[model samples]
Target chain A: MLKTRIIPCLDVIKNKVVKGVNFKNIKVMGNAVEMARYYSLSGADELCMLDINASYQNRKTFIKTVEAIAKVINIPLTVGGGISVLDDITDLLNAGADKVSINSAAVKNPKLIRQASIKHGSQCIVVAIDGKRHENKMKVVVKGGREITKKELIVWAKEVQSLGAGEILMTSMDTDGVQNGFDSSMLKKVTSNVSIPVIASGGVGNLEHFYLGHLTKSTGLLAASVFHSGKYKIKSVKKYLKNKGVPVRL
Target chain B: MKKKVIGLIDGQSGNIGSINKAIKEIIKGRPYQLKIIKGEFDNSLFSKIILPGQGAYATLISNLKKLKIYKPLKKYLDNNRSYLGICVGMQILSDQGHEDKTTKGLGIIAGEIKKFKSKKLIIPHMGWNSIRLNKEDPIITNNLDNKDFYFVHSYIFQNIKKSNVLANTHYGKKFPSIIKKGNIYGVQFHPEKSHKYGLNLIKNYILKS
Candidate 1:
C-alpha cells in the first residue's frame, strides 16, 4: 500500500541551506549537505530543495545543490525554482534529483510541462503552484510568490494535470509563515479538481494541521518553518499521524 | 586467484556515486580490487559489469550509443559475462520505453517498459516496497527475507519471461521486482538505498560472483 509522504522543504541560497519568513528575511540554517543528511536520517520521506535565489541567478543553483545533497542522502530529492525548460529538467534529473518541480516556469509556458513529461516520465516532473486567496477566490502566484498569475488555482491545477504533471504541490502564500494551519479550503478546491496526487504545503504548525491537511485529500504534506525551526521532529509527526489513525508510514 | 573486476559503467546519463558506495559497502574491508570505469566501456578487463541509472530511459540508451558502448555491452552479455542493471538501467534492458515512444532500448531482455497505469497508485512507486520471493534464487535469497526494498520507478517491464523473475511486488498488481536469467539480473528497486536488506543483497551479489 502506498503511504502518504512527509517532505521537508529546504531553501538554498548560494549553496547554503536557509529558512525564511514568508519567503523573505532569510536566516542561515546549516550546510546544505549536512542538513540533507540530518533530514534523511530523521525519517523524512522526501526532501525538496527550493533554490530561492533562482530568479536572481542567471543559472539555477538547484543542480549543484542537488548534487551536493545527493552525495549524503540516498532518498528521493525534488528540485524546484527557475526550472523553465526541458534542458533544466534534464540537468536536474541528471544531477541526481529524482523529480524536477516547476512553479513560475510552468505557469508561463504550460507546454514545458507537457514537453518535460514526454521527454522524461511524468513522475519526473512536479508542477508546484503557489496560491493566495484574492477576490474570494484562490489565485495562483508565480516568481517566488511575488507575481500573481491571471489564472484560478483549480483551473491551473487541472490544466497541469492534463499537461502530464504527475503530481501537484500547492502552497498557500498567505498562510505560509503564519502557521495558522494549512489552507484547507484552497487544498479542498484544488485536490477535488485534479486526479493526480496533491501535496499540501504551507502553514503546517502542529500535528493537527497535518491531520487536517490529510483530511483535505492531500497525498502528501510539506513544511519548512515548522520543521526547520524545531516545532516538531518529522519522526514524532509520523508517530502522531499513525496514532491519529492517519495512513502514515511509521 | 584472479580478482573479479566489476566494471561500473559511467556514461554521464546518471550519477554512479551511490552505486560505487554500494559496491564499497558490499566488498567491505576485504582486499577485493574493484575498478570504476567511465567513457566507452571496455569489458575486456572486468569479469562482470554493473550498469546503474536514475534518469530517462531514452537519454541513457542514447548516451550509451553516443559513447559507442552499446554494442560492447551486448557483446559482453552474449559471452555470458554477468551484467546487473539497476533502476532506469533495468528499464533500458527492455525492448522499448513509453516515456519516449519511438526510442529503442538495449533489448537484452524480451519485454517493453510501460508506464504503470493506475489512477490510485502514484506514477513513480517511491519509498520502501516489500518484495515477495517467487523462487529461491541465490542472489536475493542469501540476503533478503521478504523485506521491504526501496523503489522509485515510473516505468516497469511488461511481458517479461516468467523464468527470469526472481521476485515480484504488488503496487496495483503484482509486478516483477527482481528478474534473473543465468548471468544477467536486473532489480527494479534500488538496493543501495534500501538500507540493511539492500546492502545485504549487494553483498550477496559480490560474494556469489
Candidate 2:
C-alpha cells in the first residue's frame, strides 16, 4: 500500500543549511548533508532542499550542495529555486537530484515545463505553485512570494499537469511559516482537480496541522521549522498520524 | 578469490550518479571494481551488469540502441549473466511500452508497459510502498521482504508472466515489483534512493548474486 510521505524541508543558502536544526538534547551539528541524513534517519520519506540564494553565482554552490547531500543519504531529493531553463534542470538532475522543482520561471514561460518533461521524463519534473490569497481569491505568487502573477491557482495547476508535470508542490505564501496551518481549502481545490500527486507545503506549525494537511488528501506533507527546531521529529509525527488512522510508514 | 567487476551500463542520458555512488559505497574495502559502461565495453569484463534507469521507456529505447551500450548489453543478457534493472530499466524488459508513445522494449519478459488506470488512486504512485514476495531468491529478497522501497513511476507491466514475477506491489491492483527469469532481475523501484534497505539490495546484487 502507498503511504503518506513525511518530507522535511531545508533552506539551502549557497551550499549551507540556514535556519536549521538546533537540537536541545542531541549533540548534532547541522550541515546540509548532516541535517539531510538526520532527517532521512529520523524517518523522513523524502527531502526538499530549496536554494534560497538570491545571488546568481550561488547556482554552482547549490549544485555542489545537492551532490553532497545525495552522496550521504539515499532518499529522493527535490531541489528548487533558480531553475529557469532546460540546462538548470539538467545540471541539478545530473548532480544527483531525483526531482527538480520549478516555480516562477515556469509561469513566465509555460513551455519550459513541457520542454523539461519531454526532454527529461515527467517523473523528474515537479511544478511548484506558490499561491497567495487576496480578497476572496487565491492567485499564483512567484519570486519567493514577492511577485504575484495573473495566473489563478487551480487553472495553472491543471495546465502544468497537462503540460507533463508529474507532481505539484503547492506552497501558500500566506500560511508559510506562520504556524497557523496549511491552506487546506485551496490545497483541496488543486489536489482534487489534478490527477497527479500533490504535496501540501507551507504552514504546518503543530502536529495536528500535519494531519489536517494530509486530510486535504495531499499524498505528501512537507514541513520545515517544526522539524528543524527539534520540536517534532518525523518519527513522532508519523506515529501521531498513524494513530489517527493515516497510513504512514513507521 | 579473483576480483569481481560490476558493470553499470550508462546510456549517457540517464541518471547514473546515485547508483554509481551506491556501488562505490557498497564495495568499500571489498575486492570489487566498478566499471561504468558508457560507449563501448568488453562483454567478458563483467560478472554482473546493472542497468539503473530513471527516465521514460521511450527514451530508454532510443538511447540504449543509439549509444554503443546496446550490442554489449544484449550480449551480456543473452549470455545469461546477472543483470539488475531499476525502474525504467525494469520496464524495458517488457515487450512494448506506452508511456510517451508506442515504443518497443527488450521483450525479455512477455508484457506490455501501460499507464495505471484507476480513478481512485493517484498517478505516478510516488512514495514508500511494500513488496510482496512470490518466489523468494536468497540474494534479491534477502532482508528486503515487506520493506517499503521508493517507487516513482506512472507505468507498470500489465501482462507480466506470473512465473517470472518474484515480487509484486499493490496500488489499486497488484503489479509486479520484482521480476526475474534466470539471471535477469528487474525491480520497479529506486533502490539507489531507498536508503539502507535499497543499499543492502544493491550490495547483495553486487557481492553475492
Candidate 3:
C-alpha cells in the first residue's frame, strides 16, 4: 500500500537553514545537512529544501544544498524556490533531487509545468501553491507567500494539474504561523477538486492536526515549526496517525 | 592493475546519479577504474557493467535499442560477466511489464512484472519497507535479515521462478525484492538512496567479483 507522506520543509538562505513565523523574522535553526539527515532517520517520507533567497541570488542554491543532503540522507529530496526554467529543474534532478517544487515560477508561467512534466515526467514535478482565505474564497500567493496572485486557488490548481503537475503542495498562508491546525475547509475544497495528490501544509501544532489534515483529501502533510523546533518527531506523528486508522509509514 | 569498468547502454533517460553513486560506494576501499559509456558499448574494456533506471519499462527498452547497446548488453549477460540493475533496471529483466500497456522486457528472468490493482492499495508504493529473505543470495546476505529498505515503484516481479528470487517483500502482495540468476542481480528498490543497509548490499555485489 502507498502510505501517506510526511514532509519537513527547510527554508535555506545562503547555506544555513532558517525558520520564521509567517515567513518573516527568521532565526537560524541548525546545519542543513544535519537537519535533513535527522528528518530522514526520523521516518520523514521526503524532505523539501526551499531556497528562500533564490529569486534574489538569480542562481539556484537548492541544487547544491540538495547534493550535500543527498550525500547523507537516503530519502527523496524536493528542491524549490527560484526554479523558473526547465534547465533549473533538470539540473536539480541531475544533482540527485527526487522531485522539483515550483511555486512563483509556475504562477508566472504555467506552461513551465507542462514542459517540465513532458520532458521529465509528471512524477518529478510538484506544483506548490501558497494560498490564503480572501473574500470568502481561497486565493493563491506567490514570492514566498508575500504577493497575491489574481487567480483563485481551486481554479489555478485545476489549471496546473491540466498542465501536467503530478502533485500539489498547498500551503495556507492565513494559518501558516497560527498553529490552529490546517485549514481543513480550504484543503477539502482544493483537494476534492483535483485528481492529483495534494500535500497539506501550515497550522499543524499537534498530532490531531495531522489526522484532520489527512481526512481533508490530502495525500501528504508538511510542517516546519512543529517538526523542526522539536515540538514533535515525525515517528511519533506517524505512530499517532497509524493508531487513528490513518494509513501512514510507521 | 586497476580494473576498468563500463556502464552498459547509456541513454538520455534513467537516473544516472544513483548509478554513479553506487559504483563509487562499491569501490570505496577497492582498486577499480570506472567509466560511463554512451552510444555504443564495447565489452572488452570493462570487467562488469551496471544497468540503472527509473521510469517506464518500454521507454528503457526502446532507449537501449536506439543506443545500439542492447545487443552488446545481451551478449555480455550471456557470457556471464557481472551486472547490477536497480528499480526499473530490475523490472526490465523480467519477460514483460504491465504498466500503461503490456510490453515486452529483456527476457532475462522467467517472470513478468505486474502492476498492483487492488483498490485497497495505492499505486507507486513509496517509502521504507521491510524485506524477508527467501534464500541466501550473496548480494543480500547479513544485512538483509528483517531489515527495512527504501522503495518507490509500483510494479513487482511476478511468477518469478523460485530459483531466481533472492528476497521477497510484502506490500499488498508478496513480491520479489531482489532477483538474481547467474551473473545478473536485479533490485526492485534504489539501493543508492537506501542508507547503510543499501550501501552494504552494493558492497556485497562488488565483493562477489
Q: Which regions of candidate 1 fall more than 4 Å away from where they truly are?
A: A55-65, A84-95, A115-121, A245-249, B1-3, B11-13, B24-29, B32-40, B54-62, B95-110, B136-138, B141-146, B195-197
Q: Can you write out model 1's per-residue Cα lDDT over B87-174, one digit (the tens) per residue?
A: 8777887878877465798777888888788876655666667788888866886647567677777778899999878899888998
Instruction: Give the per-residue lDDT of model 3 (tens digit) for A37-106.
Output: 8998888888988887775553445556778887777767888877778988988888778888999889
lDDT of 2: 0.86
**Candidate 1, position B188, lDDT:** 91
* Per-model C-alpha RMSD: 3.3, 3.1, 3.3
Q: Which runs of model 3 end up more than 4 angstroms from their true locations?
A: A1-4, A41-43, A56-62, A144-162, A188-196, A214-219, A234-250, B1-10, B98-103, B113-115, B118-121, B143-146, B154-163, B170-175
True contacts kept of 1: 0.23
Question: Could you give candidate 3's fraction of true interface contacts?
Answer: 0.21
Quality of candidate 2 docking, DockQ: 0.76
Task: State the DockQ, from 0 to 1, for candidate 1.
Answer: 0.31
* Model 1 pairs in collision: none
Ranking by DockQ: 2, 3, 1
Query: What's the distance in Å from true for residue A120, model 1?
Result: 4.5
**Model 1 TM-score relative to the real fold:** 0.86
User: For residues A1-250, could you state the per-residue lDDT of candidate 1 as single tens digits?
Assistant: 5567789999888678887776677789877788889888888878898877875463455566678787778667888876777887887777777778998888889999999877776766889999988888888987657888899988898999889897898999988878888999899998778777788998888889999998898878998877777879999998999898875555
CAPRI grade of model 2 = medium
Which candidate model has the greater DockQ, 1 or 3?
Answer: 3
Residue pairs with clashing backbones, model 3: none
